[model samples]
Target: MSTAYGLTAVSLVVAATVLIGMFGLRISRTTSDFYVASRTVSPLRNASAIGGEYLSAASFLGIAGLILAYGADMLWLPVGWTGGYLVLLVLVSAPLRRSGAYTLPDFAEARLESMTVRRVTSVLAVLIGWLYLMPQLQSAGLVLRTAAGTPVWVGTVLVAVVVTINVLSGGMRSITMVQAFQYWLKLTALAVPVLFLLIAWRQDAAPGLGGDAPPTFPERTTVSIGTDVTVRVPAPVTVEVRGRVDGAGRAGPLTLTAGEHTVARDTVVTFPAGAAVPHVADLPVRTDAEWLRPLAGREYPMYATYSLILATFLGTMGLPHVLVRFYTNPDGRAARRTTVLVLGLLGAFYLLPALYGALGRIYAPELLMTGRTDAVVLTLPGRLIGGTLGDLLGALVTAGAVAAFLSTSSGLAVSVAGVIAQDLMHGGVRSFRVATLLALLVPLGLALSVRALAVADVVGLAFALAASTFCPLLVLGIWWRRLTVAGALAGLIVGGGLAGTAVAWTIIGGPPGGLAGALLAQPAAWTVPAAFAVMIGVSLITPRSVPAGVARTMVRLHTPETLAVDRGTWHPKGA
Candidate 1:
């Protein structure tokens, strides 16, 4: 693939995003436009905007990589992610819009009638936003480094700058347009390439895509490892190498019967045509048969699968970015309608990543050895179909990848910055500019400092945290009339503390294998239930502490806007 094409594609995406932001700036003259698009967006546009911002690096790049590496078990990821919105639509969407809060903290304060709860919600919103933002930045680095052959930091900084500028221009109103445009751009980008790829696959007529054997190199191939990787090879073979291997510098052919071999950073290893690709130390190696069967290929597969399902299904409602988008709708019915359309849009977009993953397993198996599976989506175009057409397809994918990062990062920056400006600084455009800087910087630092994990896996942690903290609060505050301020605060503390600790442990200190590791890595299954239980128990105990306006608030949340009764649709100050 030509680096020029990738760079051009990325450049165009950035330019388009900024231009869209400027267009939004033309209409964004007031605070309401900055925060919630003046709550005038129709269902279809809001849904498209939501879909744009919602499909992050995890959907664009990570799902295919995980599916390529893990096969059937990883399919649950997309299923859960899509189904989570179903959970959201049925439970939170309309009532949340009815609540008339511009932000999650606003919702918290309205429901609990406590500034303390509002502050807690504000902090949790920031935490979730930053946690989600880190992986978006990291994935941007990966995409740019692959597409344009640039330094990883260059991509991260580029996304940060573009997102900050866009957010500062018009805030949510601007981003809504940018995001809605990107959603279609991304869908077309992925969908068109796959058509070409499928044609190429048919012309080649390659077999063994789902064979019983492990993946093998079809021809002599040289794989350059950008990062150090420990690979477990099944058999010994002589291989030509350049750079460090197992801490020893080697520049010539070497023979090794491998159990595990360390290929140092920047090493180029050449494998013979028929050599079986080795598995990365972090991922499980499996036969084709096992890979085709769910729960058969992974350690503690059942537990991990269920945990993943729980995390994504319950987690969607808690995301600060997602919740912020709901406020863009004009009314409760529009919110519900937006969610239904989102389900369709998201469902359609998700189908393509699985296709990419399946094709990747057949054509790009060497990624397993290099632990660069995430690059499979970018590399497949060139590998499957070479020449100018291949380069064009690759560039399209690159553009989509860039759009993914820009749309998601922009939304997160806006959400986090909104919370910070509203809660900490003055509620105005100037404070928002300051907040955007603060929001982007901390996550960029974290993205650089942390070891790169699978993008989807890291995102799952954010979901888990969201599921633990806000899922309970939203569910209880809206549905349970007896919920008290004490209950919401206690639940947020306990759930956020546990989930946050688990996140730290997984990131800073890798967890050990077995049930404990599975539990820690995917904490939502236990943590979400624990949060709900704590909130409910505490609410029951302190029933007398329920807000005096509970009846009116319930009526406001449940009543139709058409009814002349107040539905809490007042304009929010710092929302």
Candidate 2:
């Protein structure tokens, strides 16, 4: 694809988002508008906005790439992600909306009647938002580097600057429309190019996926290693080399053994047609048959699969960015309706990425060798379809990729800013603007400083962190009237402590092989249950610490907003 097209596509998305936000700024003139769009969004628009922000890089780019490399087992990711909304609709949406809380901290304090619980909740909410934001920035960097030849930091900084401007302009009110618009743009951008791609595949005699064999390069391909990486080669193959390999410089054909080999940064290795692809050290290598089988290629597959499923299924209600969007609905009923519509919207958008992943195996297997499978979606448009037409489609895909990053980052920024401004600054538009800047800055630095992890892997860990903390608090606090202040606090500390520990350990030092690796990589199955058990056990032992207003809080949470009652809407303490 032309560099001009990539730059133009990115510029258009930025311009469109800003223009839409400016339109929202015209009508947003009060504190309520800044916080929750004055609680008047229709269900369709609300659901669209939710889909816009929710379908981060994980949904748009990562899923397809994971499927390309890991195959059938990876399908569970989308299943768990979409099914999470079902969990939210059934257990959380109506009650959370009826609570009339502007943020998680507000809900925690009102339900438990303790500023202590509120403060803990505020800290956890901010942490979750930042965890989620880092991946958006990282994915943006990866996309821009692919689309244009710019350094990764350029895309990372660009997204942060744009998100900060939009949130500071009109807060949630402005971003709602901005998110809603991006969702359709993303959908169109992805959905349209796929049709032509499928047509091209059919015209090429429908190449087989190398039945029961490891992925192979379809044609001669040259792969440039971006960083030092060890790849596991399944078989020996003669390849032309032009850079450092195994601490020696080479410029001619060499046969690599069928085992681990190290390729240094900036090395260029050329593979001939029919060469077995060598994958990164960490990724699972599978034959087509094994790839089609469940739990066949990965380590401790059963434990890893179940743990991931548990995190995504139970974690949706815990995500601060996702939960805060409910407050934009007009009433509890609207919240429920919006969630129902979100289920459908998310279901529709998720089906497109799998196609990209599946076709990638046949058309773009070189990505597997380079360990940049995430670029499969962008590469497919140019590889299968060529010339000016292909570049145009590629540009459209680039635009959609940018939308994925910006839409999701904007939501996270708004949620984090809302918490900071409400809980710490005592609530005001100016405070919110300052908070927005802070929210974007922390994640921007993290994105720039930390080495990039797989986009989906980082997001899954964020869900685990959320599952361990807010999942227990929200579920127990809303339904179980006996939840006490002390219990909530203990659970927050224990749950957040364990899940956070697992995430940090997994990121910093690679886990040991066997069960220990799987456990650290996906801890929700154990950590989530441990969190709930601690919250319940502690609450039972400390029954005396239950809030005196528990009964009234229950009524407010469970009651329909249509009912005639004082429905004490929650705000930050002393606000």
Clashing residue pair totals per candidate (backbone < 3 A): 0, 0
Candidate 2, residues 1-575: lDDT per residue as tens digits?
88899899999999989888888888988777887787778889999999999989878898998899888778888889999999988888888988878788988988999989999999999999999999899889889988997888999998999888887776678889988988999899899999999999999888766598888888998888877888988889899999988889999999999999999978999999988889888787788778878887478888889998999999888998898899889788889889999989989998998899889988787777678888888889988899998999999999999999999999999889989988889677888888998899998998999877778888999999998999899999999988999899999999999999999887667667888888998999999999999999999999999999888888898988678886565554323
- Give the C-alpha miss distance for residue 316 in model 2, angstroms: 0.7
* Residue 151, candidate 2: alpha-carbon lDDT: 85
TM-scores across all candidates? 0.98, 0.97
For residue 566, give model 2's deviation from the true position in Å: 3.7
Residue 542, model 1: Cα distance from true site in angstroms? 0.9
lDDT of 1 at 379: 91
lDDT of each: 0.89, 0.88
Off by over 4 Å in 1: 567-571
**Residue 3 accuracy (lDDT) in model 1:** 95
Number of the predicted model whose lDDT against the real structure is largest: 1
Model 2 — which ten-residue stretch has the worst lDDT? 566-575
